[model samples]
Target: MGANDLAKGPQMRTVIFDLDGTLADTSGDLIAAANACFRGLGLGDLLDARHDAGTALRGGRAMLTLGFSRVDGVDPGEVDRQYPVLLDAYARDINSHTFLYPGTMDAVTRLKSAGYAVGIATNKPEGLAETLMQSLGVRGEFASLIGADTLPVRKPDPEHHFEAVRRAGGDPRKSLLVGDTATDRDTSRNAGVPSVLVTFGPGPHDVRALSPEATIDHFDELDAVVAQLIG
Candidate 1:
């Protein structure tokens, strides 16, 4: 839809998304990366791809910490020590098991056609996020891609969301965030923007607890949710 043209004027409204567990289900690959780290330490697949998926989506450090907790007499700085290994492993084979959720591309195409600027704001490291998107062949779909290292601060911090909106040439005040976690909900709240939480993530979402502006069970419901929130 030629939606991300930098020369074009800002769209009246914007819809930013969280990458992991939102536009894509990246848990399998993430867990695999952490397992690589554990395997290197002779831990041998400490994390189950299906069971530890929720931790995987949280990020490499979280997965390492969880794995460490299950073991006895582990080094105190093991997570930090293995983080680089995890990232290296993840980057080497980022897209092996990662996949866009059903209707993700369709929803983005529909939103762009409808004149809403779109972008990604994620806690994933910028380079990995960029590589993953490029591998999945949807990097161009987003007008902007901001990551954990993109700014000095990240999610649950308003500027991270604001920067993505600005980069997308859209007004932050008239934007909404679609994500699947409490961090996303807090980011939207901190930005004074509406939030749409997804229930089709690695696990069931406690929507009432997070208390975002809205929730959706699938990407097919996203367009309507976006329109209802910001249009």
Candidate 2:
């Protein structure tokens, strides 16, 4: 019902994952899409994947804003106008360069085997998130996906995480959030759920500064970390 509700109800184990930079390295494709939009405007590739990886994970608007800032005449309005174009380009080739983090699927399988319901809570648009997961052949693996557009609010809005757990049929009180950004850490705190930040994301935030409940360098350590946090 609310953020407090996430800490109530029967204990039902669940793990909510942040898609980009957490479960998958989608920055390359994201940057490419943004670059495609800039190129269409005859501005050429405005952002580089290596340089703007963090912005890419933050989403299209962030990347567009950053790119537009670097150009001479582009403004927020132009960024807004080009946002849909970026999405269209991304949708056309969602999986061209996107890839799951190493050992992600194995960890996910282990979680499923251990009877923990798994779901996704990402800031990406709902349709794009669905498209990416389906294109990558892993849509069936997740019980639920709550994206930026899935509800009126998104992370660091805890309601997004709460809805994800509920949709997964898992009790929010027994849920853990696995992500790669401060936004996810805040979402977990707001939801009263333990947070685990992975070091593999494109974001530049120091995981130590975020002070998550736990930090993991690789998905290989996820099972033990999740068990320790919420099991």
- Model 1, runs deviating above 4 Å: 1-11
lDDT of 1 by residue, 186-230 (tens): 999999999999888995447657998999887889989898899
lDDT of each: 0.92, 0.92
lDDT assessment of candidate 2: 0.92
Error of 2 at 136 (Å): 0.7
Q: Report how far off residue 85 is in candidate 1 (Å).
A: 0.6
Candidate 1 local Cα displacement, residue 50, angstroms: 0.5
Q: Which tens-of-lDDT digit does each residue in 87-191 have in candidate 2?
A: 999999899889999999999999999999999999999999999999999999999999998899999999999999999988888899999988999999999
TM-score against native, each model: 0.94, 0.94
Candidate 2: misplaced stretches above 4 Å?
Answer: 1-10
Candidate 1: residue 194 Cα off by (Å): 0.3
